[model samples]
Target: MLGAFVDGELPASARETLEARLADDPRAAARVAAWRAQKAALRALCEGARVSGEDAAPDAGQAGAEPAVLILRPSGSWWWRAGMAAAWVAVGAGLAVAATMLVPRLAPGLAPELMAGAAPTAARSETSEAFARRADIAYAVYSPEQRHPVEVGAADEAHLVAWLSRRLGKPLSVPSLAEYGYTLVGGRLLPGNTGPAAQFMYENDAGERLTLYVASSAVDRDPVRLLRDGNRRTFYWSTERTGYALSGPQTEPKLREIALDVCGALGGKPGQW
Candidate 1:
């Protein structure tokens, strides 16, 4: 019933009754909120990808340039929207796997260089940079949502962790940032460079949001690195198991501190350099 309300599929009379119930039932209200947030997150991800693809395509008027083709046939059909969403999920999974495969070929000397204490450089594989940039973009797109910032609220921490863990095929945990005055708002599953990714969001009392993006990667060990795109700052690193990127509009020092907390919570000890 709440799902139908969230999707706008409820009949007029049914919708009114649902709204009346939601007005009184806190649990139902929370479920409705989660559903709405999930829907908005999906729309944001799809639109961001669509806009990015369009921006990258060559102009149709350019000599020998082929026109970009985007299928916009979903219109208002729920089935078509669902199918398109599934297709996008598959595309993301495939891209992530392809990137994982290319990491070795693109940077054959990466492991040795890292072992020699060299940092990732301009010569690093495009896949690493893409993953970080995508994390930044996802943060920018979803963090500012007023009504629906997270697909699941922190109250459902166990289920959120379990669901994302299953999707990513790895054990997952959410770190506590209470020491920094930010509590977990919740998390959602996203597309990663080689497979499924998970994003956990935290919010401070001031309403500031920070996101931690976790994904599986071929590159196992990398130094803690800071990346800045526009006003956002990200501290990203990788372990033998997975890669992590924490992004927000916080100061460098603050983000670094939080990153260390995250690392400690995740069973790592990243040196401050």
Candidate 2:
């Protein structure tokens, strides 16, 4: 139940009930916090699949080390099973296999560059940086696709927004980019650091593409900033704990203009971000 709540998979009514309970019982809230941290650490290990030498996995042949090789038991779903297998295959006997033991030592003991990127209470700066990087990666991976770039097409805009809104636990508005020569191609659901994220893709007649990545966050309103990652450029900001990043191959000035437009179209106040 706590995991479901943290994931925003619980119904709103049940979530309210849980929140009330958590408010009355500090232990419940603590449990939720710890669960979210564990989820984040696991996600990091799976994505990075590497451990710093000092925090490396316990030796397999060392005495008393066998017990530390924790295997993730999947919860009887095809997706879970596949994820488990992928993590195992990716890390072998490395980070993914040892994240359970590795996470506890993360907070003040390791560098921020490690697999455990940040603590649960890390500043909005960290979150915004990660959000932009993820957006850059997402654009590089999916924007080049000639087929199936998005799970839902623009024709079903209502359904796409509704579906992504449910997953992110926040209502979303799909901004029109037609004025800028880019039309909404579609959008897709994505995995976020803490929960779920959504990405909306747009394309121009010249086949150039841009993507907007959005996710629920816990951040103060941050002004838009540009991040250049290789050939991709991203303009990212956060308002009321919701992070947004617009990424593409366009010129910095052009992309910045479009990002500001998206921020405005989504009802973000000019001073808010």
Candidate 3:
């Protein structure tokens, strides 16, 4: 191990490990110093033994015996080699960092929309907090109305579904909350953060209401998420290229129960809840 270190034959990590051991062990450090000194002496002896020709006479008292023929490298050459290797590694890391920071800045002509899928930002993926807030706002605006709560009444359920599916660029289905005691009142068109949104409203016997807001989502899939606004709550998730936010005034436990059923009916995974 000591010979490999002196010859610079060990890999960097192994060299570092051995170096640490040497620093803490006086006997090991002594061995390294002795090896270095011995190498220097051998290199000096080899250089001084150099002669003009192979036919030269042997030294005075050593006649008929071979002269010193060992070839030794200078002690400092290994350190020089190690320094060049480290410099090359540093240069490679610098190039990688520069590429990451400069590539996008160099291409100013690329449209933001064209790069949307390549680099999805928060704008493309609206957070659950914003989704829930929008559902709450839509419900607050329309739920109080008696005659115009919806743009299309439930009497034309088929038309409303078809119209919404076309506007959002994806097929949509409304899951009945009737089992949880709310009946569908109707649905309407609304503006979403990124595109057109659809809102389907429902009310129970006591007139308390809920709204399911949906829009085109870049998010392929996500687990169910819940959000709370002062007097309201929302259970939201993204699935099958669409985002759904259900807002109501019910407690979290009650709303959670209703949200799971709604999720199952809309083909969302049961484990997501």
Candidate 4:
């Protein structure tokens, strides 16, 4: 009995039964307590405080969620490992049952055409937030690094447009940023969690860089939305043909100014693109 418990070979139902029996049997309780203490001490020595109960609880009632399961593999000599295999199999079966009851929700729905999956509108909001966070990360990645700033620099105006147009599936042109004291730095193809996108970068003589990430709507979207978040500003709008997003650390007024110029230079329809 002591050996099975030490090896954690008892099934959960059997363990529960033994636990109750131990409460009534002082000798069994003493042995279990000693074993637990030794296990805790070993774990503490190996993993430090991180193995402590500091894990935050996951959110409830989310679809496509899966609970985490820990598997303990047999690690002794071949004979010992063979002896433990059956015990681990029982534990694995128990975990499979528990997982059916406690599946985790998917990561906030950043997939293309989620409406086809019939997800709720609320879930869509979470997806948008996730994208915004990703946009910030994209900005951070390209904002630095002077040498490899853009894939196609401003000097190759014709080439930049041709490449971006082929990648974005749209006719793209480098909007004149001279008025804003910025020139085209280059452009690149960025993959979003939901779909593919195109990012066109620009730079001013002061060396400030701005970027535009363009992708078509992954879901049915509103006509136009302008979001200014802290140092990052986003101008997002969906037309019949495509969706456009201009994001940067510029102010709302400045972002709008650049966006209008981009639209005009692209020959995009007036009002919004």
Candidate 5:
């Protein structure tokens, strides 16, 4: 269990089970810590070797300079060659460790716990919190785009809503935030875990933008909640047929007010602030 945890190969439920046991067993916790430390050391060694090799490489501008070369002379004894072979094997092992650590970072949309060398906690299917986190990540990824931020603009709001409604299998509406100094900028269609989702964007005169992410859900009752990730605050809720998340870089109190307005416009009850 400790090895799998360090390698980030454990399933979420099994990892949670191991973590619970570790909390009660100090010795197991210590072992896990040692494993993490060893992995870190191996990664550092591999990085140092790479940096050193890069530093030793000839610069492109030094074209007139002689290129450096390394030549290996075999010793007379068989044991000497065997020892060198073993050293190369050790170096290969170190490189493998570094590559393992880099794989998660290079992969798209990897869980934070996996990249951090920790096990992820299990989540229920179509949970509101999980949906909110996904919405937040999508907002963070797309909100900064200077071009092509949305698939459809507010100039075509009627068509955009109709298209998304057909894809999501639910009636969709765009909330008006004109009272809050925000005008509809545009909207976009996004792929959700269970089905298609829609994102409606609004921008104020100051250029600050906010987004409403809506998708179909099976929950019959409202599961309204507020979540904060980095500088963004999201208020999420679910109805019998749809889930909604409003995310922006605004104060919680202000975002909550906007969330209420959005809920009211959508004809859903907003959670008490």
Candidate 6:
């Protein structure tokens, strides 16, 4: 009966069979919990990590040494009898495997590299730097000469905040940059596999432009970092509480200075921005 449960083939008959066996044996319950936890750990590891089916099974002699070793070997009479019931259990286990997977795909944490990448890129990495760069490029191509800054304009600041906040899963505010000699032209909503995204445009007196790309963190498991790539300098860093990526074209020192001011205004320490 315990073997049937471990094989994930426990059907009504198996349950009836196991009920009698388990009723007299306390170890059966412990085994079931252990197997469940084992399934859970396997599912969690699979969230973003790739694996081959061959490596999915637990080693035989290692069984019960750790609950994670109780690999569900779905076969034989057990699965045949239970069918989809076992499938539903597997799905429930999968959901428990990772709450981050349940977040809206557009809401951030889309790519693992930004989170797992080396150092600062990893630290300040939100969902995807590629997406951030793509977003910046898209804005650069489309927003100049008032070609079209946004689907929504500054007049709709309320809608802008709510819509972007919903997509990013983080509170967002368009920092008033008028003090920095820039005025908000407007903002645009963008597509992201991890979640909805937003870009706020600010232009100075000389027509110099800067866009703030905001999104949710892909992982909160690490520190913040600053990344410089191509023609852009990004002050990417994360707080123990959250993550942020600020990228622009200025020199590293200038970008760093701006990042410091922005971080200060955003209630984060300047050293991190």
Candidate 3: worst-modelled 10 consecutive residues by lDDT: 57-66
Which portions of model 2 show Cα errors greater than 4 Å?
Answer: 1-126, 271-273
Give lDDT tens digits, candidate 1, residues 1-273. 777677677888999988998898866898889877775555544543343435755543444443344456545889888998999999999998886677667887674674476756444333666778888988998899776778888999999999999999989889889989999999988877657889999999999999999998667676678889988998887776688889999999999989977976786668643
- lDDT of every predicted structure (CA atoms): 0.81, 0.82, 0.81, 0.65, 0.80, 0.62
Query: Model 3 segments beyond 4 Å from truth?
Result: 1-105, 108-124
Runs in model 4 deviating more than 4 A are: 1-133, 219-223, 264-273
TM-score, candidate 6, is 0.46
Model 3 whole-model lDDT (C-alpha atoms) = 0.81
Clashing residue pairs found in predicted model 5? none
- The candidate maximizing TM-score is 5
User: Cα miss at 264, model 1 (Å)?
Assistant: 2.1
Please give the ranking of all candidate structures by TM-score, highest first, separated by commas.
Answer: 5, 3, 2, 1, 4, 6
lDDT at residue 99 of model 1 (Cα atoms):
68
Task: Indicate whether candidate 1 or candidate 4 has the larger TM-score.
Answer: 1
User: Over 4 Å off in model 1, which ranges?
Assistant: 1-126
lDDT per residue for candidate 6 within 1-273, as digits (tens), equals 576676556787867877777676665677887987786676555543333453444443453422223335556776676987888899988886565555435446544533454454454444545544555565455446465656677788889888888777777877777776878777777765355667777778887776776655554433334565577666654443344556666687776766667666665666532
TM-score for each candidate, following the candidate numbering: 0.55, 0.55, 0.56, 0.51, 0.57, 0.46
lDDT of 3 by residue, 153-272 (tens): 888999999999999988888898878899989899999988899999999999899999998776777678888778888898878878888889999999988887887788789574
The ten-residue window of minimal lDDT in model 2 covers 60-69
Better of 3 and 4 by TM-score: 3
Question: Which model is ahead, 1 or 3, in terms of TM-score?
Answer: 3
Model 5 agreement with the true structure over 1-273: per-residue lDDT tens digits: 689786778988999999999998767899999987876665544443333334654442342333344445565889888998899999999998987788667875564656576543334246778889989988897788776779899999999999999998878889899988999888888989776889998889888889999987767657568988889999988766688999999899888888888987887866443
